[model samples]
Target: MNQDNRYVICMKWGSKYPAEYVNRLYNMVKRHLTLDFQMVCLTDDTTGINPDIKCYPIPELNLPANLPERGWKKLTTFKPELYDLKGTALFLDIDIVIVDNIDCFFTYNAKHEDSVVIIRDWKKPWRMVGNSSVYRFKIGQNTYPKLLTYFEQNFEKIRQEVRHEQAFLSNYLREHHHLEYWDSSWCVSFKYHCLQKIPLAYFIPPKKPSGAKIIVFHGEINPPDAITGGGGKWYRHVLPSEWIKAAWQ
Candidate 1:
């Protein structure tokens, strides 16, 4: 209910994604978000990030170092009393590119105060699974704690059942009656929505999807890769997209 408490928070960790990713995300939010809110980054290191964005240490997930990284650390974002953050919190993955005004992300769900809004999984439309790259939730003593607590207690069983953290979260939130999805067009997937498919992908340059507000880059491709049109493998070649370079800054 406190509109002043609105925050756009993101996470960054390790050598895979540097501080620049967080910095770019902050710049994007500042450019597109006309709403009054704070910008935050939760990470192990904050070197090179701009000071305007509030930085917070990522809470420990308490998992063993020997385990495979299936993005389980993201669950820590749900820790009931996360630092001093309160009210509507938008959790964004560092790899995403904002292509249009995102003030709607906060206002579109203004009426559904209890709904946990996320982007619907591009691959699995039949099931209620959602892509966690972009999502909105209240930042206090809501039902958020249960997601992390349940995973901590049942990691062995959970890791086998779900492919990754987003999959587990999508199903759990749906079953708990807290799941809501953003409009499909607002958060379009770059791989599925923008790039030409297969054979055509080789000749045609990636086109920015019309009316897309936030272009999500998941799995093998990222913004850097989109600029060069190299997906790290021969089969995934995309013609360089000029629009990605324009928006990523």
Candidate 2:
């Protein structure tokens, strides 16, 4: 496997996000990443996806039917030898907008052999957690087999214990002392960091934070909603911005 090559991976399953989400994400990534890389979309429907994007069926987790589907499928990314994807892999959620150069995400900790790198969850203040909107690891490396095996064995107990997949993975890494965080400024939350005060949000459309490579849309304010001011709630608001239109294009 060539170390120079970067593999960017993302998944799309249900109708919550359309094929356009994947297409927009690919364009944003191309505009931002200045590296030799291939973008892979693990998806169930590829009807409207671009021809250039490498599409593969979403890897099955084989979890019980009772288990919630929210973020459980992401666990498949940890499976050893996932689709034989090689080199450093950076996982980006389809909802994210690339705002700056992301060349460093692949090379930041190249010297460290087996560490899980992720964004510090902006919502969690008391305990350390990884947001997982953007994260990096070597494909097929199996950096934390014990954690993966444990989750598989104790699927029910782990699900009952943690709030979600990100929390469970965070606890696993934190316990093992192998979890590291990208600079807080690099991957920022749109709801919290971008638009803090409700009144101010009405006047000033969200701006790209300094040194931010990716702007994450964790909750209700997705890129489309942000652009059209269709944000769900009163507190969760955004002014229309031409920049978002260009970035999403």
TM-score per prediction, in order, is: 0.94, 0.93
Tell me the lDDT of candidate 1. 0.85
lDDT of candidate 1 over 1-249, digit per residue (tens): 463588999998888999989999999999999989899898899999999999999899866677877788787878888888778889999999998999999887434556789988889788778888999987865546577878888888888899899889887876764788898889998888888877888899888778899999887899988998787356666788999999998
At residue 115, what lDDT does model 1 achieve? 71
Clash list (residue pairs), candidate 2: none
In terms of TM-score, how similar is model 1 to the real structure?
0.94
The number of clashing residue pairs in each candidate reads 0, 0
N/CA/C clash count, model 2? 0
Best by TM-score: 1
Q: What are the RMSD figures for all models against the true structure?
A: 1.8, 1.8
